[model samples]
Target: MEQKQPDVVDIFAVEERPGAVVFALAVCLGALVLLAQMDEQTKWLKGAALLVQPRFWPGLCLAGFAFFALCHFISTWTRHRKSRQYSFLPPDELANWARPTEYALYFMAYVFLVPQLGYLPTTLLALPALVFRLGYRSPSKLMASMLVGLCTVVVFKTLLQVRIPGGRWYEFLPDGLRNLLILYF
Candidate 1:
């Protein structure tokens, strides 16, 4: 006797998902709204209290988009069920959930390190580890990651003159090495 196949819900597919994607989108929009509101809520009492005036326009735009998307998705969710726009993603059971979990852990580590180690070092370190975790054993991957980091430093630090944190970790290095790092970073 043959076993019956389990029914799979492809959340991206119109006929299959039963409107769950709409709910998910709504939730995402809700999150954006909350974040944007928080950004506006924390404006400096003395006007741009940080070293520079951080941009607030992007947050404003996100808030506006979230409001409209919430309205549109809620209203049209049912109507769109008849649509043929199927999502390409496989069912949750077939999806590799472990990857996201691993990445989330990496993200948490990145957050903890950013303040102590800063952006340049954090990014340079994260790239090689991420590439290794993703199972790319080739030396080229490591080289490429380093090259990308170098390009990022040149473009953002040298060309654009963007202010990236030098991080405290670099200070622990010997004088010559630290000076070399500071020159590039």
Candidate 2:
């Protein structure tokens, strides 16, 4: 009896993820470059109180992301080279996929709606939609998930006093709504 070797296809399948990795690296690099330029514009302020200088933390974070992304890109490239297979997608998968597109659209919608709809409504809607899409079938589970999400938002926004994205819809709601929300939660 002979042991079967792992298929070349299986090893190279990992390479397909490099495209996503490269895209992330490019985005991080772009953010770092932007932060560096902004830092240069505020060079005069650096001479002020060292603790008060606004750019220090953000610039450091951006630099850190860039460094990490660079390492990831290099490691992924080496893996791709060793695997010796260049495939953009899985062998049987279609190029024009709608699932990813749908998720992106949902994310954008959530961002845009957050400021107007308030935290609770937007999250309540998005949570159930995501849960259902992820193949969760039980109504009880969906309700429980939504409740947890709503509570998290309430804790962050109300108890923690964290700034939540407020939208036009929030503005139209009566003062009673705010009072009601605060009292109920």
Candidate 3:
């Protein structure tokens, strides 16, 4: 003789995926911020039709966004609380999200160096150095990065005629070469 087994029942079983709650919270906060700024960022024109008013459509969209985001956040919060999958915030997921900030700072440094070092020199140096930093030791890969950098400089400075200031160091070069580098390189 065998006893009967009871079935498990879960009404609020949310799919346990990493970063879902964090993403929902971020979206909710962002939408709320944008909705709060709607009055300042948009204009209310006098005697304008509702359909054509500058602020009307933007306000409607922002309100809808905020409402949906709040609903999503509440739903996720309730479901996660019931399931007990996470406590407070997920530090590992947040750290992974912030990992790209280093590259952004690197890019900012490159932008700062361009005026001091000139476009051609900065691009050439930075690309290879970045490749090396990423642990590529092969000569071919380094040379390829350098070539790509040179082509970028030529396209922007020479072909497209975009205005990038010459390096401060160009003042030490001879007149003809300095002029050539400033104008085309």
Candidate 4:
């Protein structure tokens, strides 16, 4: 007899009680600890006094996350009384997920190489690599994407006066490049 295959919904369902309980417990505990730290930093101010405090927003965010995580834990506990084995991702879909790693690595390479290659070269190289890695086979899409990315970077560096890594190469680029960098950055 052939074994029954689990449906996509079943495979991804959070029906494993132990996993849900553990995940929720971890998040709640972490949030509580974070809230305590925030309270310490904010000195537990109340009412109008709390409104003026700098730590108020961070503390509120932590408390909110803790509340939601706890609610999810409780709801999961009630709904899935019995633990069910489930696959997090089916084998068939794994290959598609794996392709993005190449793009991520290329991005990291650009980050590390930016100071050495200067912003323009690093960005120019990273953009094409990323576009190709994402399975864009058409040369037109790749060129258009690269041009758009580069133009956006140049505009920010030049027109907006945003600072980007330029290294020693900044002084040597043509006046047009410098003007573009100054205007965009």
Winning model by lDDT: 3
- TM per prediction: 0.48, 0.49, 0.74, 0.54
Which ten-residue region of model 4 has the weakest summed lDDT? 83-92
What global local distance difference test value does model 1 have? 0.67
Better of 2 and 3 by lDDT: 3
Alpha-carbon runs more than 4 Å astray in model 1: 1-77, 80-105, 118-120, 174-180
User: Tens-digit lDDT track for model 2 on 70-178?
Assistant: 7776776677666755543433333444448888988899888777666777788888988898899999989988998789887887688676655556556689886
Specify the highest-TM-score model's number.
3
Q: After the best TM-score superposition of candidate 4, give how far the Cα of residue 16 lies from its true spot, in angstroms.
A: 12
> Mind giving the per-residue lDDT tens digits that candidate 1 earns over 1-185?
99856656644454445435545575767867677576566554355544443435545556676777776666565455556455434355335544587689888998788657766777788888888888988999988987787688788876786755666788899999877666557
Model 4: residues >4 Å from true position, as ranges?
1-23, 33-65, 82-106, 171-185
**Better-scoring candidate (lDDT), 1 or 2:** 2
State the lDDT of candidate 3 residue by residue for 87-112, as single tens digits.
55778878888998988998999999
lDDT of 4 by residue, 1-185 (tens): 99888688876675453345555666778877887677467655456586677777877788789899889877765555553442333354456557678767877887888777667667777787777877897999889878976897767765566766564566677989866543443
Candidate 2 — worst ten consecutive residues by lDDT sum?
88-97
Against the correct fold, how does model 4 do in TM-score?
Answer: 0.54
- How far does residue 45 in candidate 2 sit from its true spot (Å)? 20
Show the lowest summed lDDT stretch of 10 residues, model 3. 5-14
lDDT of 4 at 180: 57
